[model samples]
Target: MMALNSVARADSFTITGVNGTGVTASISNYSLVGNQFTFTITNTSVAPGSTGTITNLGFALPGNRANNFTLVSSTNSNYTIAHDLNATSGSQNFVSSFDLVLIDKPNGNPTFGGGSVKNGIAGGTSATFTIAGDFSGLTADQVAHAIFARFQAVNGDGSDVAGNGTSPVPEPMSMLLFGTGLAGVAARARRRRQGAKE
Candidate 1:
């Protein structure tokens, strides 16, 4: 006999500005199923004459030990997000860099200095982007705890924001086991019906 359980969970959050730039960000429509995660992020400026750019975005997996995170999809008109690298050590962190450009600045406005810019995401106007990835490295006992995102503007203002969200739902192995159990039950039912017919 086998006991199988299936759980589905989803979560979302709004990111606060820590860089004194009056820029706000939000993550919505987040869902997790069997090690797959997806979410959307929207960035906007609250104050006038304020423009910014996103430099980096990352997610923190607390107990997971595997580093096989892969970006599945992304959609945004203003910015481009690309997978950067894993963290140094022991911190199951996945990072992605943003391609954004600043526009119409005074003489001393800050810039990326041609170091990390990629696809030219502009400020002042609102921009929204979505990202989906698979975290197959997580074990049955390990789960994701929190999500972190960081960004910077042309004025040298930046923020590293943390948001709370739903933890990893179920392990892939557990899902497989549950499927096998269901198949076994179906097979037994068919056999019983054939025996009675004979």
Candidate 2:
């Protein structure tokens, strides 16, 4: 059984594009509790047809936050959570350094449904990650836009799939509002010009 975790108004983000098959992508969940942050990442697709399994989630910490956070534990024994990861795991590349990585062992963990020969997050299975931080504001605002996912095939046919997400994905929405405000300004300017001409 998985550990007893607080559901507590969790926040989620979408991850997509794995091996072009688009199989097993996810809308993962996360929450913060007193400087201890917990999140669940699952690989599954309801529409069917996913060829790859998610192998790891690598969080690229911003600035020099490598020492601020530490991997407390993973709910699954088949997984290993670590800090100060500067390299890539499978096909997931890191453009920045000092990452927190949760990786599925190559040996694989058995939790029913035959077995994941590749030791990845099989469809419908989830791993809740717990991370402890020394800082006070250890909220999603600090970790948003810091996540990337990796995938692989147990049979080795595929595993080089990578996906990234910004938890709140703020840019596009902010842009929309900014665009609207600019358009309004432009319209007002045009109206003033017409009044002056009159």
Candidate 3:
């Protein structure tokens, strides 16, 4: 059996295949439930004449535990360039960015995930948005947690959803376990001190 803690994680996840169109990103086998997790996607590179939109904002948390994790809310925005500089072809050049963050835990707790995007593109622009999960009904103060989540962006032709055409992998469970271990150590130390005083 494992426990949950508030320690931060050192593991990192790479948002690859996020090139031309976008990426359908998700997490799986998360032990934590009833807690909202937020993620973001940014465009690194785009075809000179290509365009797309950020929609279909939803996530799936398996285990028939809709109560575990639910898509409570989402926010997205972008900047588009009307035309190329020093050009008279009247061809509009559009550059877009995306940002997503976990503003609050599902139980209406004030906590955040990751950080925000500074620029707009994958390399140039950086956009940020957030998806809040709701875990208000859970009974325990320290509930087990895990997650399976994903998002996608598609172009006029759905075949080109991902710019690089790859998938996003889940972060390692080591950090989560490390957090549990550290908590155990702290608890043990406190217990020892209390016993000495008695």
| Steric overlap count per candidate | 2, 2, 34
* Higher-ranked by lDDT: 1 or 2: 2
* Candidate 3: segments with Cα more than 4 A from true spot: 1-34, 45-51, 67-130, 134-198
Error of 2 at 45 (Å): 4.2
The TM-score between candidate 1 and the true structure equals 0.46
Model 3, residue 164: distance off in Å is: 12
Q: Which stretches of candidate 2 lie over 4 Å from their true place?
A: 1-7, 45-49, 89-94, 105-118, 134-138, 141-144, 154-156, 165-198
Error of 3 at 110 (Å): 28
Prediction 2 TM-score vs. true:
0.61
Clashes of 1: 2
Off by over 4 Å in 1: 1-12, 76-145, 154-198
Q: Estimate each model's TM-score.
A: 0.46, 0.61, 0.32
Estimate, for each residue in 1-198, the C-alpha lDDT of model 2 and write its tens digit.
Answer: 544333433455556654465654543556667777777777664344555566666666655564566677776666665566564433444354445666555534321112233566766677777778743533454463466666555234554444454445443445777999999999999999999999
| lDDT tens readout by residue for model 1, 1-198 | 654432333343455544345555555555555655555555554456444554445455444334445444445433333333333222222232212222112213232222232333334333333333444554322322344444444445443333333454565677888999999999999999999999
Q: Rank the candidates by TM-score, best first.
A: 2, 1, 3
lDDT computed for candidate 2: 0.57
Error of 2 at 117 (Å): 4.8
